[model samples]
Target chain A: MASNTSDLRSPLARARGLGSAKDGTEHWWGQRLSAMALVPLTIWFVFGVIRHLGADYTAFHAWMKSPFSAVMMILTAVVTFHHAHAGLQVVIEDYVHVEWQKLALLIAVKFLSFALAAACVLAVAKIFIGA
Target chain B: MANGSGRPLSPHLQVYKLPLTAILSITHRITGVGLAVGTLLLTWWLVAAAVSPEAFARAQGFIGSGFGLLLMFGWSAALYYHLCNGIRHLVWDAGKSFELSDADRNNRIVLGAAAALTVLTWIVGLAVW
Candidate 1:
């Protein structure tokens, strides 16, 4: 590798880590914000599932078809996937050292998270809208 | 080097004993990863329901099976742990509980609460089942 000593940057400037991506802490803030939203969504989801525990197809379907239940399910799906995507990104970046592997995993994570999130919302919408 | 005398260096992670808080910190990340993986199950359930009664039946059969129940148990535990520890993290983000003793105490509290909640959930779940 060639050194760029011709630049006016100081050692401290280079050592200050990867610097900013101009986006700042958007990712960090998104994770926390999604997490906050999930705290209640998850609790509601768990209890709701429990209430319908062992419920037959008709019961479960009817419950899901309810307006409130459908809305909550969609919101939970979106927020949870968003939070999961951000969390997995941090985990991958921490442990995956190979450049190509890291890039591939990041892309896969992003794509899969969004795809699953969309699938979930679509599923709920089908149930809700009776489509 | 300033310490060219070959003196003992500060202990690195491998050389140092991990404290309770350190263990809990890593557990938090692990549970977060597990929950991420668990989302596939959620998607499967939702999609199955949206499909047809037959598809939903298959999904329900798997979930009600022994292996499926085992996976549910694990997912519930992971979810509860991640949720509890996540709240602790949010609190830390607010600049509290940085004290060594307080952090350690809070770790134990988080662990206990997660375990208790998981057991209680399962107990209620079984009753409903």
Candidate 2:
């Protein structure tokens, strides 16, 4: 086992040996940390959206363009995607039995979350910047 | 040994009665996924706003439609449920409320609070709308 030439396992398989990744706590802690941040942020978001209910485009756009709303919107989007990805990763791991498919889905989730978060930030930034 | 084939498996989901705590535990995950899905609507709304008034109006029009309103209602309920249960989880993380009775009671409390909050939100939303 000590000699690389004697070992037949592929690098990926060797790296994926059945042992603790030693980073499990990162996922747990991140979920909790983001959940805490989201408590107040989600509350603020719910109330804000309700307040804007039935408002015209100009009115709604104005609210979205406001400084506080813009900042909170970006914060909410970023933290939310982070938290959501962490969560969906666990769900996928638990349920997806096929290894390759699970890996592909996990990668897709991460990429989709990042892309959506970026789109959200750009939208808010564009509106708030008025350009 | 690598393959799990021909082995007696443990009783699966429908094999036993689930307690309230267990149900809510799974519900937390369900709502978490639902909220993740709901985020797409949020993104669409924002992107539409950034695009133009016309785009925003179209977005608003769809959201005002019956199907869209139903989705919003479901999303809000899921949000409140997730929020309340999430706080309960945070408390558990702090090493409190591990008692079975406490967990059971908190499960009811979380469900009741989520329901009340959801109803109150829609009431207020419609009133102001």
C-alpha TM-scores of all predictions: 0.88, 0.87
Q: Please state the error at residue A116 of candidate 2 in Å.
A: 0.5
- Which pairs of residues collide in candidate 1? none
- Tell me the tens digit of each residue's lDDT in model 1 across B1-129: 348977887757987998888888999999899899989999998998899888888888888899999999999999999999999999998889899889878988999999999999999989987
Candidate 2 - CAPRI tier?
medium
Tens-digit per-residue lDDT, B37-124, candidate 2: 9889988998988898888888888888999999999999999999999999999899999998898789889999999999999999
**lDDT (C-alpha, whole model) for all candidates:** 0.90, 0.90
Model 2 segments beyond 4 Å from truth? A1-20, B1-11
What fraction of the true interface contacts does model 1 reproduce?
A: 0.75
DockQ of each: 0.68, 0.66
Q: Candidate 1 at residue B126, lDDT? A: 91
